[model samples]
Target: MSRLYASLFYQKQVTEIFSDRSLLIYMTVVEVALAKAQASVGVIPQEAAQSIETICTAQIVEQLDMEALVMASEQAGNIAIAFVKQLTAIVKASDEKASRYVHWGATSQDILDTACILQCRDALDIIEAQLGNVHQTVLAQAQTHRNLIMIGRTWLQQALPITFGHKLARWASVCKRDLARIGQMKPRVLSVQLGGAVGSLASLGNHGSAVVSAFSRQLNLTAPVCTWHGERDRIVEMASVLALIVGNLGKMARDWSLMMQTEIGELQEPAGNGRGGSSTMPHKRNPVAAASVLAAASRVPVLMASLYQGMVQEHERSLGGWQAEWLSLPEIFQLCSGALERTLNVLDGMRVSPEMMQRNLECTHGLVMAEAVMMALAPKLGRLNAHHLVEDACKRAIKEQRHLKALIGEIEEVRQQFTATQLDDIFRPASYIGNIQEQIDAVLRQAVGAAD
Candidate 1:
């Protein structure tokens, strides 16, 4: 289920994708594809290729002793060494003659890199779908509250009045751009890795290019222009995109957390019997989903840096650089997956308090509408005079604990410039939200097109 965080808030699909079992399965898959590629060119017997395919099942791959395999991998410099050994043994048991062609004409880097790409392909599907869900959730919020008035804050202080839908639609627009970035990254990151030793394909001689083409077809991946043994740009780009996704989610969480504060009380994450409960304080409705999303966001940048560091590989092969990716890539995918799911859940069930938003708008005592009043008086007085008059009124209103609207009416300059009804209109929250409906329509139109 896509709801991978419902039970205990742990994502099982992400765990399974990068699991030890999955590693062996994809490695075996790569080896079998290579065998099939070789067989297509008559470099190896077709019977051996067929046998390799039969024994590469998840059940058979799990039979090897994992403890010894891990120790051997530490000594042998790569897991593929111990893994191919075990795979050769398994093939030998079924048919002695077929064992010779298990991982023919391929380097360990080829097997591992292609396997990791396969895993990335799987992770991307999940992320893209979840991104669509987030886009839809934000779109729904915008459409539902398109005209609902709220105070927009700058530097954590009330600055002006804006529709809640306008705020949500801005996030939706950002998410639409994120989806575009993911689309652009897909082709770049999904290319196959099939180069032999030193990336020259010298092991397969003249048949190297043919086998590479066939192998890419077998795995349903794009053929790379050349071997990416030392080129780690695609991997780094993917990590960067995931980091951006988490960062954006974190921003939303931070806003939600702040709005849910007791003083603000304009929003709340969905509440259930045990969903966001406090251990001691009965009144505390904690932001559990935001906590996970923010934590992932906080840590993803460092993980992305590790992938960027991996881009500095040694010629045709890397020692420490490739090793950095072994743990970092999987960790990036897992953290991003969990963060995406949490953000989706948070948006899907969150509650909004329109009344509270209205109340909070009045908390500043019409200071949020200072710009509106200034603009209405700008043509009557010069721009500087209007600004000074409104600015003086604001200070007086704050000092006397009075509304700016009422104080502005008493000013001679403001009274000469505008009538009582005009002054009242200038202070209204809805009067200041310019073109918000048009913007909402435009954002929703793009979102609908994206869904198609």
Candidate 2:
């Protein structure tokens, strides 16, 4: 009724970035850049660029009649047409001659698409900062728990032993890869769109290419090989990357939620005065951050599919497909921002209990360490024979309610081959961790190398 995951965890920074004011500001940015770009090629006077730039602030755009603009947009089939008229009117009041060239050679799609790219670039900056924080938190977790032994579960059941740091290291590796993807895609996705009417630049004639190049330079964006009026792959690719990054966030949420369960109790979300609480149950400190992240993960795919669907534009310009991106991109960015913030909060406050981890490790009654005990005897008893012997011992140990090590000594073949010290060392969970630190180091090094 109120909001999913509640308004308590709502991220204001995300909401502000997609606000009506923000959108208008970016659209005005595109218009000012257009004027400045035209001036660079002698299409518009330099004084006009200066005049347009002076009044293009968000504060100025906020003063215009947005409701009237939206009402006017319905007849025009889009908002940018009415918005450009408002800009022209405002500029006319200040300097009449400059106002005539306000939206000179650009179509609505050019202004709208370029404005969307500007917003997206800013949104990615916020996302990148949050993601970096997550990377640092995960890396710290791995370094802190490098030797914290825990049970590794498969199919929701204990399967083997692993160091807690190893699990954290895996998440760190995922964050690093996600950052790399964002960096690679930003250049391609942040390019300006300046094809007029039908991706032809017909109005500007010989000066179109120069204006386009200048527009990109003025805005500090890349110049595309050609116009992308009907080509929607850039937005689609960006949506795909955002969806993938959120999927990784969902993975972390699922793992933390499971580990926080009473039966497992190996990990916990941060405890606070109004965080992760259940209204009726006093015993319930629900993993709300994880729930929020998981909710976002589940919801984003539908929006992403819409972006993908928007890719099917017809001819050099599309009627419906171009309209689809207006809302979907903002929604996706907002969802990712909320999810990223909650995830970072969860990581910052997360608590790992080695005591509980150790207790749970024994819940399997030494069955999880089977691989370790089995390996130690493999060389002595021959691989097949040793596996058979340990497998038989495991069954007996389970039935007799005794430890695996207790039963290993009773087996004649095992007793004949090894002494008490060998069994003692082999059965320890510490012995089974096996190069986890080295693996962690390698992952950290690889992430650092990729960054460099």
Candidate 3:
């Protein structure tokens, strides 16, 4: 929780949104909104609501002692208790009548939960924008490399040929799904939390529901059917979605790091400004962004799991479960936002070496094309017979250190089955990549539709 490495591991914008000062400001905004809502339903005097609003400005909230508030929170069981006390005192100095109505019927959970929702709204906006940037960058890469042939691996060994765009399109499709999830989750997670003590607004009499509606309207958040003092699905869902996004980013980073290996050299993270530098070696170009993303990906799921465990709260209000979220949720947002930002950077500046890809594709010396040759011969010989023949040729090709195609040319069955011209076409990398363009196009069309 120390901010020593915050700039390196968390997005600066998101970090500020979850800052201590921002939290105080959000809590103050909630109290102000509550006052105005109560007044709208005639639960409190309009003049009193006006005075509370006018007195509790950002400037006034800034004057409150944060260090004292933190110290008091340790003894008070939660920050909102101390925060409400300070806010009431501040309003008392300006107008005595307004002080009486400060945080009038609302409890600590209501204020704190509403403030957290407000924070999540802002944090989600940043994440959505970053995801959009990454999605667009991936689409561009897919479009640009649609036909750039490369070797596709299975179990880390060359299996067949595929276009690099096919790989990028898969990332694009996942990003589109992530965007859709963000859209679906906003309404549920952005709902205002307002319940007087113990999940019911018993103190507000008949005006409780009205105040809830008005408060939600004032904040531009959805009002739930009832209070969720003990229910924690919304918070958990937000963490789940964030974890899902981080997981996808980790997958991309893993592939990128693998491809950036010196033996592969098919791709590289962008170089400049002393990035990807080595501390001890002069010839190192590390996948720094990818590594950062992977670190976040590894860390966020465990944080998200804590939230899931926090879901089993006691009735009305939790003893320890509810408080667990205070520590887990913001950290989840911070790590997820960091991962999204790093992914965008990598996608934007990634270096794709079509030449190296082609070279690596051929490094196997037609061994990669064995499947294509086998399929071509499958019709002449029985399927099992063709598999055996190609299997034998593959071994001979490796032992003789010669191309599989040349070795296959010497086989009597292959000579009788096809001409040299046909065999030449069988080994072409592009020829073996099946329907990759159509797949990429389908992904791109879905991405465009999602944008619309």
Q: Which stretches of candidate 1 lie over 4 Å from their true place?
A: 1-10, 450-452
Query: Taking the tens digit of each residue's C-alpha lDDT, what string does model 2 give over 326-402?
Result: 77887777778778898998888898889999998887677777888778888877888888888988899889999
C-alpha lDDT of residue 148 in model 3? 92
| Per-prediction TM-score to the true structure, in the order listed | 0.96, 0.96, 0.98
Global local distance difference test of model 3: 0.91
Which segments of candidate 3 are over 4 A away from where they belong? 450-452
What is the Cα-based lDDT of residue 235 in candidate 2? 86
Ordering by TM-score: 3, 1, 2
Q: Model 2 RMSD to the real structure?
A: 1.8
- lDDT, candidates in the order shown: 0.87, 0.86, 0.91
Tell me how many residue pairs clash in candidate 2: 0
In model 3, state the lDDT of residue 351. 91
Q: Where's the lowest-lDDT run of ten residues in candidate 2?
A: 1-10
Kindly report which residue pairs in candidate 2 clash with one another: none
RMSD of each: 2.5, 1.8, 1.3
